[model samples]
Target: MNVYAQILIDEAKTRGITVKIIDEEANLYRLCYGNNSVLCRESLTEKTCAMAMTICDDKSLTHRILYKSGLRVPRQAIYINMTQAIDLMQTWNSLVIKPASGEQGRGITVDVREKEELQQAIKSASKYSEHILLEEFVHGRDLRIIVIDHKFVAAIERKPAFIIGDGASTIRQLVKKKNKALIQTTGGESQIPINTETERVIHHRNFSWEDVLPHEQELQVCKTANYHTGGTIIDVTDEVSYTLRTAAEKASHVLNIPVVGLDFLVPDFSGDDYVIIEANERPGLANHEPQPTAERFIDFLFPETKK
Candidate 1:
């Protein structure tokens, strides 16, 4: 089962809500508190409108909708052909190529600087989705802000996966050690994969898997700061600027979504500048520990269950 669903189920039980496993294999369940009952699949519940989910699931459409609403968004276009891809390449200088619709950064390629890189990125994205998105690669850390019941509940600043040098271990050894810890903690959902993208990131920094990094040095190994992509997150609910909170709320309002995790790329959380990247219908409530994410989600699902 996804750790996300497990967290919600545990929270529901703790709140005195009757938790029923409708489909354990699917991570589907029913939470009943008194006369009210809600069906949940992972952190996603019936409260999310299909239309809102549709818009968010499509990256190009999400960007268009938010951009039309006068919200800051990265320059984006569909990858129709090599011609279009190269035109965007020359225009943006740095680009992020990914499937038009997907999650967990499965087919995302970032920091495409030139023609050859762009070609490979398009191929990578094409494997997942026929309609690929070519987005301007905004330089910033990922900031995930959760808005539930039309109110900001939690914010997390995510840094791409990295391994700190311990002097003796090679990059591969460090990665194995990291993966071991992640599997033990994250139910195997957040371990870093040894893939070409990982290789590209390491090589970009002039580092190799065989290289023994010096002690105390931190090396970023992934371009995407998605938790599923092995990124680490720190709760920043108190640190998120009021401006950002408002922007996130405004986005959910524009989408008319009751619950969402809005992804923002920002140079800094304390600053005002940022580009809204994507909206996740099912944000990982478990990741926001001690912040009442699961509690608030349950409250929204069955307000009568509030205690």
Candidate 2:
């Protein structure tokens, strides 16, 4: 478990909530309540336990159920073999390859255009799980919508927040300085490593990391807006439009899951249209800070149960 995960558990306990570390992998499993131990354990039957466990462990099934419920998700294909992956990408030259069962953007590759890169991405992503998802690359920003008990709780817009060079410092130095601050804010998850690919991207623009610096800002860096890749997260729950709310709520209803975090890619969620990228059962509640998603989660779990 990550630090944030542990913080969530601790926060729940502080609210007079009792949480047991069950061997089960369900993200948020409630094994009954009240002062009766035997009764609580007996209350959750095999079928109910299976259902709760099933939803949290699988992401492909989550999207399938949401799609049937009328949510606009990205065009994607689930592939098990290398041949199937190549065939799926044939239709779309550019696509995202990721593990169907992973979260927190682990083992996810975006803009895989060449066959070699595709194969590499597949091999890398496959390490996380047997099933892989090949999704059409949607040109838009990443939007995260948090839902609790059939209601929208919080929303955030994650944008890659990178600094450009002004022809002064080395890329390594700039990256180090940026990471120093990012680690303090994001608990060390947002620090982007200076790699050859990143340097190439800078070089492709006819610039070098040495030409840019802490003093002079000359060259532009970064093409994508992923916060995990040293981007910025903007709180936009108040700015979310009715369309986004409807899409998110409908997605939750379609999945038949009480707690969910829906991701969307769009020019603007306050606008008329957008694509419902995917739905997550074990959505990271720690991403939305200051708002305290853990508190909302505790409220959702023990709401009146504690009283």
TM-score of each: 0.96, 0.75
Instruction: Give me the runs in candidate 1 sitting further than 4 Å from their true place.
Output: none
Error of 1 at 293 (Å): 0.8
- Residues 136-228 of candidate 2: C-alpha lDDT, one tens digit per residue: 888887798888777888899877546755455677677778889989987776766475435644766676766545455544344344556
> Relative to the true structure, how large is the alpha-carbon lDDT of every model?
0.89, 0.67
Model 1 quality (TM-score): 0.96
For residue 32, give model 2's deviation from the true position in Å: 11
- 301 in model 2: Cα distance from truth in Å? 1.7
Give the clash count for each candidate: 0, 13
